[model samples]
Target: MIKNIIFDFGDIFINLDKIKFANELQKLGISQNDNTFTPILNEYEMGLISTEDFINYFKEKLQVSSHEIKKAWNCILLDFPIERLKFIKKLAKQNKHRLFLLSNTNDLHISWIQNNWGMDLYNEFKTCFEKFYLSHEIHLRKPNNNIYQFVLTENNLQANETLFIDDTEENTSAAAMLGIHTWNLIPKKEDVVDLFTKNHI
Candidate 1:
């Protein structure tokens, strides 16, 4: 039986505009082509590279200043609604199973988030999780066999007893391979707040 829920933060909680980001990057001379940039992003997400290195790579490729690159790169992190925060808190109050947040995020993004939301709000937000695992902090990222193993072994969680929800199929499939139940949510059609109702919690 599933006893723990691992939630991914991006599309699952906050909305992202792929088209907006692409258009913004185009203004900054970055390619919208998946062939060129997606693999670089994938490598960074897999914990294969450092934040500074990733930023530097973009800055050089796009021939833009760090500030310009930073703005364009961080365009995905838009808003955090009180309703979403309330929903997570409500889920936590159930006290039925351990709740965790696992995201493949890096230092620069984290620093930007801290600055954007400020420390107090971030702490309040983080309090909703039994454990908050950010890739840069843990030095382990998603879609990797070792990172998934780290979460289970370190937390003493049974793989079959955990359910991971992520927007990325790659990450979910990797966890599913380890016997963890997964929901690769399609945000365009699905409402995360309705998971409990639809999944019949």
Candidate 2:
């Protein structure tokens, strides 16, 4: 029996336009592609670099002003829907499954989100989960086997009894390899609120 449900934040519960966000980076004169960008992002997510250092590093690469770089870097955060938040909370209230949130997020993005959503919105969101795992906080980012292992070990969860939903193929694939069931949702078409009707949890 599935006793746990792990959800990804970006583009699953919240909406994001990654391509649009990346295109915005090109305005700073940076070649925002995998070969040029992913390494820097990986380092930032791993907490190996400070936000200012991250901004400065990119500013130097693209010759963009600090302010402009900040704007572009924050473009990935889109919208969080209140209805979806309530739906998740309703699932938690059922008390049939253990709920967790696992997202690959960084300090700067989270700070921006907090400023926009405020403490109350954040509190309401947290109230829906038994545990909320942020990559930077735990030093375990998704698509890495270690993170899946960490969640299982820390929560005392059975791999076969947990389901992970992520928009990112790589993250879901990693979890599936660990004997956890995974649903790789296409961000644009899939709505998390539908999970209530589906009742797969």
Of the candidates shown, which would achieve the greatest TM-score relative to the real structure?
2
Tell me the spans in candidate 1 whose CA falls farther than 4 Å from its real position.
26-29, 32-53
lDDT of 1 by residue, 1-201 (tens): 789989998888877777778887889876777577877776776667887898889877877888887887788787777777888888888888899999988666777778988999888889999899988777677888898898889899999899999999999999999999999999878867877878724
What TM-score number comes out for model 2? 0.93
Worst 10 residues of 2 by lDDT: 28-37
Q: Which lDDT tens digits does candidate 2 get at residues 1-201?
A: 898999999888878879878788777766655577787788788777788889889778777788888788788788898788888978888999999999998988889888889988988888889999988888778899999999999999999999999998989899999999988888767788887566655
lDDT of 1: 0.83
- List the global CA lDDT of all models: 0.83, 0.86
As a whole number from 0 to 100, the lDDT of residue 196 in candidate 1 is 81
Candidate 2, after superposition: displacement of residue 151 in Å?
Answer: 0.5
Q: Estimated TM-score per prediction?
A: 0.86, 0.93
Q: Report residue 169 deviation for candidate 2 (angstroms).
A: 1.2
- Give the range where candidate 1 is weakest over 10 consecutive residues by summed lDDT: 192-201
